[model samples]
Target: MPLEFVHSPTQQTFDIGSRLTRLLTLLFSLVIVFNTIFAFSVLVNLKSLDTCMFLSSDCSWSAHIDYIKDKAWSRVNILRSLKFTLDRLTLETINMTFIRPLLEYGDIIFDNCTAGEKQELDKIQHEAARIVTGATKLVSIDKLYSDLNWQPLSDRRTNHKLIFMFKIKSNISPTYLVNLIPLRPADPRYNLRNSSDIPLIHCRSTLYYNSLVPSAIRAWNTLDSSFKSADSIQSFKRLISNTPKVPHYFNTGPRRLQVHHTRLRLDCSLLNYDLYRKNIISLQACLCGDSESVRHFMLFCPLYTSYREDMFESINLLVPGTAITLDLLLKGNVRFTDPFNSQLFSIVYSYIDSTKRFI
Candidate 1:
């Protein structure tokens, strides 16, 4: 029985392997055709649009700046037209509440702006400040910013980026951006140098890399220790929002008075002398035929002698026998040592107000 069972050495079998391969090829061809049709449809729809609706995943400062300018200028123009009807404070409020928000709607877009672009955007803010405060053409931009409690657009953008990073770091929200930023190492050796140390990223495109992660990390590392040590993301935001904008030296007194003092110090007053200087109106000279300058009004003008004497006495009380020099008055270089520089500002404000009627 065993010898009777025999099998052929060369036996033909079903070609299942070739059949399966043909099936896979047909499926792949259909998939490719479907994808091609879908892509064509997308391109056709995109071409039909008047303007491109999608933002590039990569940051484009030029596009963002143009868009922001368009949004901001519309509001700014309205404010400018109403300059006669609106006071400085009201104008500033409108800018802060309405115009500024428009400018800052997608502030993360500014994180990658070149220095030149940043300066250009900052100029827009400077222009807004000038318009809001009615500052003359001659007023210093820095002084205007100080007066308005506004940070440069560059600084604001950095703040916004870091705040976003903080939110990601604190797990306040789950975002793909968190994966781009590496967590600090637990090793003491790694963290010994800077409390806010961040690991370096190696990539061919530094700008793109910075746009995604390094910029935020760099900004966060430079933050004050208090900011770094915040207990929660919300607390961190609250602290940042309430933080003093200007340096302690310039942040003296009530905000309103600070604004007034800034105007006076920057020669933005509506005195006839300043008006004539700005060519807003014609005036030959002071009544005494002296060249009408801030120095002349604050110090040498005969009309303000009484007020000058009172101001000097008040100033001397702070720093005994401190003389108010032209340099001191206009440049804020006081000889006296008030930590906040409040006394010098107060004396200057008083002197300017006192001379207003005389002018």
Candidate 2:
């Protein structure tokens, strides 16, 4: 028996490995030869599809997201293979170039997904970052994102959706999509606060509640009026791109150098102060009979005086006349210029090496 189905004039379906048991139609006489069902709302999402985009009996993307996850993890395997040869910058470039596009493709399907499904996607990114930077699974995922300046997938999805919403708002989207966005009309004589937003209608189903346009609108309405009022799409993107709160410094150095720097920044060192706080040591004091903290380890310790003096002199040469504050050198928290030069890092790394703080 052949599968019978109705086709929308605009949509063209591919053999996506979906099985159709039966089709409901008044005309049961209309017979069609096909094996798979249409991926409702996720058609032709991006050019050159890699995995089969399937639609189960229910119109859901939970299974589709799993296909995407499998593809993404395959790329992460490649990234892991090249880890020894590639630095953080190169690995991140590879991920953005190859893996990211796949994860972001057909983002509309994500609208109907549950929070747990979205978390599966987020975990892929977290693992990718860990593999690239050689960070162990024991490392805090948040710390890895912060140190590497990587945005979580959920935020990235929201950003992408808002960009599409911007296109619709700016009248740059296709007529079909623009018409589909549920917007309420405003009065000419009076002003209303919700005029620029999509109406919060009662959704009888959770699917309707979390669907594409409504969720996008909810995110859209949260933005400042100035952001939405951009004259051009590029301008709008610029405004929203900066919505993610960036850390003080975005590390671009190699992973070999970065792992130690990350450990120092996170205060995961074996300092007696840290040890004492963890109840591993009785007192937070140095062998020189002074407090053993990062400040003491870097600047004031009597033991590493020669190495510390060398580090100070080298850092002075690199950043002439600027005050060497604790945060500045340790975390590279510069307001204007990045003072974490290669020479300065070498000096600091060398100083720590001599003190054996890391070992």
Candidate 3:
């Protein structure tokens, strides 16, 4: 029989109410089980700490130790919720890392609501799950889930009542079962926070107007080998004062050119397709495609090993013992000095820019 044809308004409402109640009961049971599991995990992990001992009021312990304890407690709550729901509801044992613990908290509170209240809570949770599931991250969820060996739960194998329960307990969307997954954060229409605020109003005119120069000056001051003497200070100020005037780049202010940092060189070469490619791709080593990240390209990719070989030789000339990891470069430990560093940075930036140009 057709679903609509079989439905009586009174019977339909009763069925809906019954389905909702069962879902709530299942979800509530899950939360209790999850909480117990989480508490046990924490108790086991923190066995080293005496439960009877006073937590120190000392500032150092208060700052670091207390902060860790609070984070652990929050994790305990979420894990406990997951364990509780899974045990009572007969859910397939899937890895729980993809689940958001905070949303799990919301789900626990949601299960206790009245039928009408449950509907409202469901709406809120669905929306929140939509936001979080569609959030901006270093990697794509589809790719990440595939890598993590997550199998989509089918409605045929799974209980329809429990499907509703999954939605309630996991705070997850039922959309995945239908093969409709979200676009990643990189996509323009991806339903996540995708835009940053463009500064329209300047809070401080002088600071805003000379934003580039001031940042450079501040960066120079912050360097490990910062300019100290009066002569050095004068030279730094001269660099700031002599920057070329940008045409309304930042309210049409003049830019001062200080000592030639490779960062400034790269900024100036943003339009240079080759240099931009290398720099941007290098910077994004941690976040690029499955096998095409900066790390993979620099240290591992046979396709780009020639570039790595050249860069390594250059580094060996300047600072002989630098690792090729992107982290080491970002930390300024990888011998980024003078013409050698500048040439290397430009090459990498140019490579990145060239790839982007073709794309």
Q: Model 2, 1-359: lDDT tens per residue? A: 99988775444333222222233342343433221222221122222436456677687787888898878887777777767566666677778876887788877656578788888888888878876666655557777777677777878788888898889888889999898777676554557676667766577898888888778878888888999889998888878776454332434454555556655565555677866766777999999999887778877989888888888888787777868877766666445454455445556667777776666
Residue 125, candidate 2: how far off, in angstroms? 1.2
Residue 143, candidate 2: Cα error in Å is 3.7
lDDT of 3 by residue, 207-271 (tens): 34333322223333333332222234345344333333221111111111111111222222222
> TM-score per candidate, in order?
0.60, 0.71, 0.20
Winning model by lDDT: 2
From the highest TM-score down, the ranking of the candidates is 2, 1, 3
Query: Cα lDDT of all candidates, in order?
Result: 0.66, 0.70, 0.35
Candidate 3 segments whose C-alpha is farther than 4 A from its true place:
1-290, 334-340, 350-359
Residue 28 C-alpha lDDT in model 1: 100
lDDT of 3 at 271: 26
Q: lDDT rank, highest first?
A: 2, 1, 3
lDDT score, candidate 1: 0.66
Model 3 score (lDDT) = 0.35
Tens digits of lDDT, candidate 1, 1-359? 46784445433233565678899999999999997896565344323212222265665567766776666676667667655455566567667866777666666755566777666667667777877665667687777776667777766777788788788767775777678777776655643648457766665775766574767777777778878779987788777767454334444444444445555567775555777777787883777788666667777889788889998788777776656677666445534455626667777667766666523
